[model samples]
Target: MLNGLKTLFNKKSVDSKFGIALRSQAGSYALDKGEDTDIQAGEYFTETSESAGDWLDDLLSSHNFQGSGHLVLSASHYYNVQINKPDLPDNEIPSAIKWLVKDIVPIDPDEMIADYYDSPVIVSGTQKINVVCSHLTSLKKYTDSFKRYQVDLEGIITDEFAFANLLSHRKHSTLIICQQPFEEVFLIIVKEGQIYFSRRLRGFSDVGGYSTEQLSKGICDSLSLEVQKSMDYFERILKQTPVSEIKVLLPVKHENFIIENLDKNTNAQVSKLDLPSPFEQMRNCAASVGGLIEFERKGAEND
Candidate 1:
């Protein structure tokens, strides 16, 4: 009976004006509505529910959601890894990835759901493939939650890929460091729309409270070391040219601190991420905003 609900709720239809970007922070959920690239509304929920039907009822009644659209998920729920491209047929890639990642993934292979993104570039006859894995139980839980509300989940994407989609227009190699509220930070390197490297670092708040100056200094030192390592690997291992600039996505309150500190320490030109007009006041929700941008781009290509 529940399986029927799950299957029924998983339908994804591309023709729509609205999209939803859903992400979990701490114990709550953040949902945003996007009409094309413009954000129309956003709401946060704190209540936790074990019953999907009850949860959906509450969400629908409270938000007054009117139409079905794409649902973009958060990266925290899945494991994203990069592995050497395997020599195999396209149809057999999924099985091969399962076997390769069995020991490394935290969950059992039998209970895992896997997906992959192929790299746009082939270097030295080798390619990099991004693999995303999630536990079947968690997948079912979230799917069932939305299924009860009859929300069509267009696709599941990581925050990294969403950010990559957000910056697809750039022509040169660049590094992106995104720091969200709470204690989450991601470092990503991209060139020509392909991700070469990515890492999530421990934030200053994760360790303990600190003065503004101390926190700024800590982030600067940590970013400098990681940025240097990524640059070295890009040149030495990937044999690619160095990145021309580093773009940091941070809260407006700490933007100056990161920019000033990173500028003094790194050779690359450091700057803040440019947000679209709709997102000018809500820099903190970049992941969700990026997901909306990505969905619109993909939907247009298909049209």
Candidate 2:
């Protein structure tokens, strides 16, 4: 995902554009023509090796992603940090605050592609914003490939925004946990269709391989602690109202076991996320499928 490239969509263009989810090991595609999106889409993957650059050309060179497109870099490729808003003009925010992001992510500020989304007013009436930082060298590998192959890159997003798009507008906040197989878990809170908070929880990448036996053995109880910690920060620290719902798009068969345990242990209700239409069926690539759906707003709003 690159900065300063985004498009507003028309109904017909949804079929022409492509949505891709790029991870360390694989790339999955989705088209928004209603049902059978999987039939219309394709993916490029490699398991034995850990390369991510030109191999993408094999996937991008096809007619699949021809026009303007959107891409969701999986959680491993990027990170989000919520910090106090900098008192600067919009044009200066990137340079002024990228250092702040560096303090948290440990990357050289020059080589990081950073962007921000404003969070809700904190309980103390202080303004806050979330900064998404990606590696410039790593991200340009894919974007340069897109340019060489003539795919007009529109917008870049993460699974946090992609998965949050599935929720229907609600009066109260809902926290959603999402993962695709070996990817890190991402937690996001949405209410009335707006993203209020997001976090990337480490470990648990192999949750997709978890069996009924493993979940029943309580391998996922630490997940409750992560969920509770996030809820606590949102309620007690941010001073926001308590989130009452928890949904998951984790794409595992035994996901229910984790959900059941979370429901019993955590403060809010927990359930498996009910993805919409085409995404619901392709649970593993739900975030890529969601890229086909238009964003409620740009991921980096300060731009």
Q: Which candidate tops TM-score?
A: 2
Cand. 2 Cα-lDDT: 0.74
In candidate 2, which residue ranges exceed 4 Å CA deviation?
1-15, 33-43, 48-50, 123-125, 295-303
Q: Write model 2 residue lDDT over 1-303, tens digit each, in one string.
A: 335434322222333656788876877877643335333555668764346775677777654556555789887788777888988898888677678877799789888778887886664677888888888788777777777776766788887777876777698989998887667888888888778778878878887787878765766777888888999988888777899999988777777777888888887888888866544577777777667654323423534
Relative to the unseen true structure, what is the C-alpha lDDT of residue 63 in candidate 1, on a scale of 0 to 100?
Answer: 65
- TM for every model, in the order presented, reads 0.82, 0.84
Question: Which residue pairs overlap in candidate 2's backbone?
Answer: none
For residues 90-128, write the lDDT of model 1, one tens digit per residue.
Answer: 878877786778887887988887878786656677887
The lDDT of model 1 is 0.64
